[model samples]
Every structure is written in structure tokens, then in C-alpha cells.
Target: MKINFSSKTKILLYFSVALILGFSIINTVSFFYIKSYIDKNLSKDVEIFKRIYMYEDQSKLIPYLKIVDSNQNINQNDIVGKVDGKYIVVDKGKVYTELIHFIISISLWEIFILFIILIIANHLVQITIDKEKELKGILEVFILALTHKIKNFLGIQRVNIEILKINFNEKALMRLEKAYMLMEKDFEILIQALKSLREFRDKREEIDLKTVLEEIIKELESIYPEKSIFIKLSSFKVKADRTDVKNIFFVILENAFKYSEKRIFITDSMEKNIYTIKVLNDISFQEKGSGVGLEIAKFLANKYNWEIFNQSSDDEYIVYIKIPKK
Candidate 1:
């Protein structure tokens, strides 16, 4: 079984590993540091007083310091060490032992405190993430509901407009028809905007490259008659969701015409099972558009074996999309 971790989870795991490793090294190094301190300093004391009974009278001055003769048997605190180029028996008791214990205990306490902080931080982060997820679910539901209501209202307006078109004179009807076009376009945009972008694949089938591009071009021709589009599509069928592929191409082509100064070029290339589409146009530099079409295409591209990227300069904009071809 495979488990996929989020980026946040990966970061937290890395931090936790480093935290453990860092403290482990600190404790190890600290133990050795104190080991050498006791070896050098306490061993020298044994060289000064060569017998355990020699320090018995000075017990109040140096507690737990038991320096003894080389042949003397030591208690639990005894250790064999070299002092002044001679062998000695030494018992460095609570003085050095307490220091070692204090150091290790302090490191453990630090580890405990930091681990508690990490737990609290992770708990807070998880809470925030849960809240965000809940808010996103609520927002998606709200937008879906609002868009649906607007779609129904727009459908009614479309029907009433079509019915009343017969009653108006030529001049009034022309104005009404233009207004109708604007309303339909706006509603189409609204529907596209709120449509569940997360659902990219409702159905997958072979979609012809040339036919879909030409159909999308025809729709734009009625809207932007002055713009010229030159298409050079490769002969291939792309195995993908029809609506998704169409929406992506439509957005690319529509943006080309909508923002082009005069000329828009459409071309495609195929290699093995991959098809690449390129849309190139000179920037119009007119009133900027909403670019909701390209946004929709980008959202769809992220979900499939498709790639969409673009480059632009002061005068030209070029976009490329790579898709799987059957």
C-alpha cells in the first residue's frame, strides 16, 4: 500500500526527524564532554592523595571524594584511571556524577518541552486546515446554488425574449436582439464560471482535433468577424472528455480572437501519442478582458494528462497545450 502525504505533512515529518536527531547528538556529545572533564580533573585528585584513608579526615572539605591506594578495593563509585604517569584508584562520586546526571536530565527536559510545542503547533495547524476545508465546502455549495438560480432565471428571460421578438418593429427588435445577445453571453460566462471545475471528466471519448477546433472557431466568427484566425491542426483523435477538451480549446481560441490586434495563428504538432496545440496572436492592447476562458482552461488542464503554459511580451501572446492523442 502507498500513502500520499501533503506538502505540509512532509515538512512536519522532516522537522520531527531533525528535532530527534539533533537532540540525540547533543546528548551523546554532552555525555562524552563530561566524561573527559571527570577523567582529567578527578583523576589528578587521586594522584595528590594516594590512599582512601588520607581523604577521610577531609571528608567535610571534599564530599564523595575517595582517593585510595593502588591496591585498594573501591565501592560502587570506583573507577580505574591514570594520574601523573601512575595507576590510581578513584571514586568521583556525586560531584561528577551529579553533573553528568544534570546534563542528561536537562537535555531530556528540553526535548520534552520542544515536543510539546510541536504537538500544540501541529494541532493548531490541523484545526486551521479543517476549518479551511469546511469553509471551501460551504462556498462551493453556495456558488453552485447561486449559479443554478441565475441559470433558471436566464432561461426564462431567453424564452420571453424569443416570444416577444415577433411583436417589436425592426428597429426596436434589432435593439432587443442585441440586448438578448449580451444577456446570453453574460449568462453563458456565469454558467462557465460557477460550473464545477473540479469535475473534469464526466465522460471520455475520441474527439477529432480539426472538427472541434473548426466548430469553436465558427462560434467566435459570429462574435468577432473582424478577427482573422489561421488554423493548422494535425489529423488525430484525442482520447479525453469531450466537454473538457472543447472548453479548453474554446477558451484558447476565443482569447486569441478577443485580444488579438488583427491576426491569430493556431497550429498543432503530434509526436507519438502526444498532441501539442499552439495559439499565437498579437496583443490588441484594447480594454482588457476578464480572461475567465483561459482560467477555465488552466483549471481543466491541471486534472488530466494535459499541460498548458504560455509566454507573452509587450505585443505578442503565445499559449501551448499538450494532450494525449489516440
Candidate 2:
């Protein structure tokens, strides 16, 4: 049978196993040490008692006195003592019991200390694992975002290069210049994204959705001049981080143009306290993508309590982003 254990459970299991093994080892070592201690002391006590019985008065050590001659048979409970070439039996149960109790007490205290150390070690390990996981997630997201942005900029540069190859005129030169400027803009956006990621809970301000959409549309037109685009947006306002909002729009629109046919449509409306924007494009249903852009967009939307929905048919793909007017 397979037992599934979560991270916390696994850590606890490791600690428990270590504790049990440690306790067993300590107990075994303590038992041997205690046995040796008892044997050594008992021998010393027997020798001392033997000397006392031989040379001193009989009444002096009555409590420890247990004398038996060579002819007298010793029972199971009797400890043998030799004095002056003769044998005597003595009872050592009281002293043995006292030593056993002391050793057990010391062992329990040591185990308690070991238990505390294990608990602290487990806690530290858990914290380290959590931080590592968080760092890994951040790195993955950063790499995906960076790669997507670079690919988009490169596509524009490739197009300009193609134009230059066909005709080396003012218009081609201007297109090249535009590509370079877009590259610079892409770099700036990346820097701003990194800064925003560091301070993800930045203060929100009233954002003009209409203005943001117009700017994105213009940018897309410059990159894909051959593609037909339509936009119909009414005035809408939302409280959000400006960079986050811009990045969301950019990623969605860029994806739409990249994956769609020659046409794309965008529309927006505001009703009551909610504003919704929808983007629709034509694409083959079988086409698949890494979907990093949409993932990032949805992440940002969820972070700001906005709602995002996606729908796709055999020939049409649509996304709706709904934000609360604040």
C-alpha cells in the first residue's frame, strides 16, 4: 500500500523516527553504564562490609549486615561477599533500586532535551523549504514573462528587417527606427515590471480604461499594420496599479494578434459599478500555446479582485475581463 504524506507530515515522520532511534540508543548506553556503575559500587560496598565484619563489632552496621557461613546455602536474592577466606551473603536490593531510579530520571531529562532540539530543527527545515519554493516560483514567472516580451520585440524587428531587404528607402529606415524604439520601450516595461513585482501591493489609483485601450491599440497597429483591428470602448474607470493594468492589456492584445487570423475585435462597457472589456479573435481550435500570457493576466486580475473569463469555439476565441469601478 502506498501512503501519501504531505510535506509537513513527512517532516514530522522524520523527526519522530529520529527521536525514537535516539531514545533507543541513549537508553541502551545508559542501561550499560548504570549496570557497570551498580556492579562497581556493589563490589566496593561488599569489600567494605567484609572488612567491617571481620575486624569491627557486629552491632555497628546492622542494616547492611547479612552474614552466612560456607556451609549455609545462599538463595536467589542473596549477594555473595568474601571475608577472611569465608563466604557471607548480603541483600543489595535497596541500593540497586535507588540507583535505577536515579538513572531513569536522568535519561528522561536527556530525552526531553533531545525532543526540543528535534522540534526546533524541524521548524527551521520547514521554513527553508517554504522560502525555496517561493523563490523558485518567482524565478519561473520572471523567466516566462521575459521570454515572451523578447519574442514579441524580436518579431517586430524581423518584420522591419524584411522590409529593409525589399527596399532600402526612407520608409524602411523609419520602420527600423520604430523597431529599435520598441525594443527600448520593451526594456523599460521589463524594468517597471520587476519593480512592481518587488512591491506588488503598491497603492492603486483611478485608471482610465479607455485611454489604456487606445494606447495598446495604437501599439499593436504599428507592429501589425496588415491586420484589421476594431475597438469600441466607452469611458470606464477602475482603481488599479497602472503598470499592472497596462501589462494585462498588452499581453492579451499581443496574444490575440499573434494567434488570430487577420482580424481582431475589442469592445468595452460599464454598467452600475462594474466595467467589462472583451477581446475576440479568429483562430483554429486545434492550435495550442504555452498560455503564459493569459496565465499572467489572470494572476494579476485575481490579485486585484477582478474577474476574467475565457471562451473558445472552433473558429473564434474570446476573453472577458471584468473590474469593479471604484
Candidate 3:
């Protein structure tokens, strides 16, 4: 049996490998660079010290002292702390341990800071690449669907135009007009989708959840004036792309408003790090009609790593959206 891994699983595997390789390369580079740096500039007086003073390069100590031999190839201006570490330098036939100590103090700190920065940069770059890949997937699916829709509409429009031109009857004209209206509606939907995508680009900020919901509710109320709606939402601050969050809740709330028989009730609560929203409404139809709006909401939720699902019974429909309080 062939096991088809999910996109998310594949992304995770790639991300893990990238992180491991990135850290391993950084570590290997740091080790070699530090070793080479010490060899060229810091590890020059170890043999001299061991040969002259019988002081082990890895086990020796001193204060602010300087020792000069008659045939000295090492010079010590000043030594701070312990001198047991294998840090030695030879310059102009002068053994300099103090300079080696200072070099270690400075170089190690610099390397550590650079290492941390690289790790952070690597993680951020990986996250950005992964998100872009996901977006590309969404765009590909959308374009394919859009192309199919355009072909279908164009085929129907062409046939209808030919019929009207040949027959010139009331029925043919009505059919052609209906096709035009449907095409216009599709264009409107396309425009809205494009607008949403444009608005959602790189716009991350703190959003007042209740405030945004109220705005969506106002807009939806204008569309469904006859529908009685009630809301009891928490004033939680959520950090996300504001337009994305708006689109998610807008679709769910609008879906509720569009299908309700009499009244719609919306409420929110927070548990742990998850904010849960519930939209309940009396169903006017048993079938719940087409679920395009809910499907869109679910897609947006899944894209952002949130949770959204629905439940329906004989009398009512309920949509639940779980968002993280980040």
C-alpha cells in the first residue's frame, strides 16, 4: 500500500532536516574557525612554556607577573585570572599568553553571539519559506478552480449567444441574460477573493477580537436586516493578520445570518490558550443549502492552523471556530 503523506507532514520533515543541517554546519564551521584562529594567533607559546619553566600548558597559574628569559621567544605584558587554559602566543620570538587569553575572551563571545543570531535567522527563514510554499499550494488550487469555472461559463455563454443569434426568441434571450448575470456574480466573487488576498499580505498586528466581530456583524446586519442576531464575545487581543481573521469570522457569521430561520446567537469563551467561538441559528431549511461559505471559512481556519467545524440538527445549525490566543 502506498502511503501518501500530507502536505503538513512533508513540510515538517523538510523543516526538521533543514534545522539539523543548518545547526550542524554552523557548529562545524565554528569549531574549525576557532581552532584555526588559535593555531595561527593564540597557540604559539605552549611548547616554549613547557620546555622552559616546566609549566604544563594546560595546568599553570600566575598573577600580574612577567617572566623574561635570556633567550626569550615569549613576552608576557600582563596575565589576568588563571593561565591553565591552553592559550599561548609567540610573536617576534616572544611568547605571549596574556594576548591569547584576551583573544579567547573576545573571540568566544563574538562567536557565541553570531551563533545565536544565525540560529534565529535560520529558523525565521525556514518558517517564511514554508509559509510561502503553503501559499503557493493554495494559489495553484485556486487558479485551477478559477480556470475551470471560466471555461464552463464561457462555454455556456458562447452556446447561449449562438442560440439567441440564430433563433432570436424570448427563451433564448432570457437564457443568455441569466448566463450574463451568473457571470457577473462570479466576477464579483473573484474580486472579493482578490481583495481579501491583497489585504492580508504582511499585515500582522494586534487585533481586538470583539471589535472586529462587531464590525463584521454591522456589515452582515445590513445584508440581513430581517435576521435577529445576538453576540456575547470576549474582548480578547489576538495577534494575527487582521484581514485573515476578519475573513474567517466574516464567512462564518455571514453563513449563520444567511441561513437562519428567525434568530442567530453568537458567543465566545476562552479556555487555556484556545479561544472558542460558537454561532448558533435556527435553520430555515433542512438541507442547509450549499455550504460554500462554511467551506471557505474552514479553509481559512485550516490555512492559519486554527480549528473550525459545524454541527447541525433538525432545528438548528452551529459553527465552532477555535483560534489560538497568540
Model 3 bad stretches (over 4 Å): 1-129, 140-201, 286-289
Cα-based RMSD of candidate 3: 11.0
**TM-score winner among the candidates?**
2
Predicted structure 2, TM vs. truth: 0.50
For model 2, residues 92-188, the per-residue Cα lDDT tens digits are 6665676678767877887788778778887888887866675466567768877976786677678778877887667767766765765675566
Of 1 and 2, which scores higher on lDDT? Answer: 2
The top-ranked prediction according to lDDT is 2
Please write out the lDDT profile of model 1 over residues 1-326, one tens digit for every residue.
Answer: 99999956976788788887887888778878988887787656654555443444745644555345556545544655444344444445565678767786888797897789689868877877865674465356445544654564466566557756767456444545544554465456446534633442257787787898998888778777788888887677766677667767876886787679999998988788778889999999775545445655776665575888888899999999988753
> How much lDDT does candidate 1 score?
0.69
Residue pairs in clash, model 1: 52-68
**What local lDDT does model 1 show for residue 251?**
68
Model 1 CA lDDT for position 194: 41
TM-score quality measure for candidate 1: 0.44
In the range 25-122, model 3's lDDT, one tens digit per residue, is: 76567666765665564333444444444543323442212344334444353231123443233342233354446556756775686567666766
